[model samples]
Target: MSDLHCPARILLVDQRPAGALAERLSRESLAATYDAPVDLDEVADRHRGETVLVVGPLPAEHAHAGGPVVLVEVDADGRRTSPWDVPR
Candidate 1:
């Protein structure tokens, strides 16, 4: 909607099911999906040039994969947690 070209696909990796975020992303016209596997290497390989990875509260290791990675945190009330709030 913002004239931003959506990636071919978006991979959402979260510790818990991210139904809400996935729904929100879908509404934004971005092709999004979810995978809850313990290992991400395989998924990353399959989506090589077509996916933008979105990670939730997981280890940093799983946050960076391919394309542009977005780290999101949602509170119990479904409010998004700001990365700036994370103390250095």
Candidate 2:
């Protein structure tokens, strides 16, 4: 069985490393998660048209990606904020 409605690109992440997210989502069937170094080159080349859910302290580089990039941040107090929405 497969989720036909699921988007081609879906990513879930937190403060942990990119590799951590990739490894965790490995058990799933649709999405593909990979190691995302500070440079983020791997993610750019591999995942082209996916909505990356970076759910933690988003890296500076990711904030400037060419495609659709989502920056999710959770503070120590456990509050979630959209990083891009905050004042620069």
Candidate 3:
């Protein structure tokens, strides 16, 4: 399917804690955000419906988790890039 209609929930994985990012994502009009530690397998199983996974400074282990995975590096500039960045 086209990227515009990707059917997957958005999962945000981070090692530095997901409080700040989750808050920001929740405030935005984007997809809902699920906060979890950097556990690929667990996160994958629990949120299997996830089509787009956003990782913050965490390794990209869920790349092969049966869907498109977006790796986002939380840089010092506070910039985060992910599949979600694509305009709706």
Candidate with best TM-score: 1
Q: What is each predicted model's overall lDDT from 0 to 1?
A: 0.38, 0.37, 0.41
Structural similarity to truth (TM-score) of each candidate: 0.32, 0.28, 0.30
On residues 2-72, what C-alpha lDDT tens digit does candidate 3 reach at each position?
23222334445543324555454555453334444455444333443333344454454544332223533
Q: Model 2: residues >4 Å from true position, as ranges?
A: 1-30, 34-38, 61-88
Kindly provide the TM-score of model 2 when superposed on the true structure, using C-alpha atoms.
Answer: 0.28
Instruction: Please state the error at residue 30 of candidate 2 in Å.
Output: 7.3
lDDT of 2 by residue, 10-87 (tens): 342444434544454344453344444433434333444343433443455444432223433222233232323211
Ranking by lDDT: 3, 1, 2
- Show model 3 residue runs off by greater than 4 Å: 1-10, 13-24, 27-37, 50-56, 60-82, 86-88
Residue-by-residue lDDT tens digits, candidate 1, 14-71: 5433455545444454333454433444443344334444455444543554222343
Whole-structure CA lDDT of model 2: 0.37
Q: Which one wins by lDDT: 1 or 3?
A: 3
The model with the greatest lDDT is 3
Model 1 weakest 10-residue run by lDDT: 79-88
Residue-level error in angstroms, candidate 3, position 40: 1.6
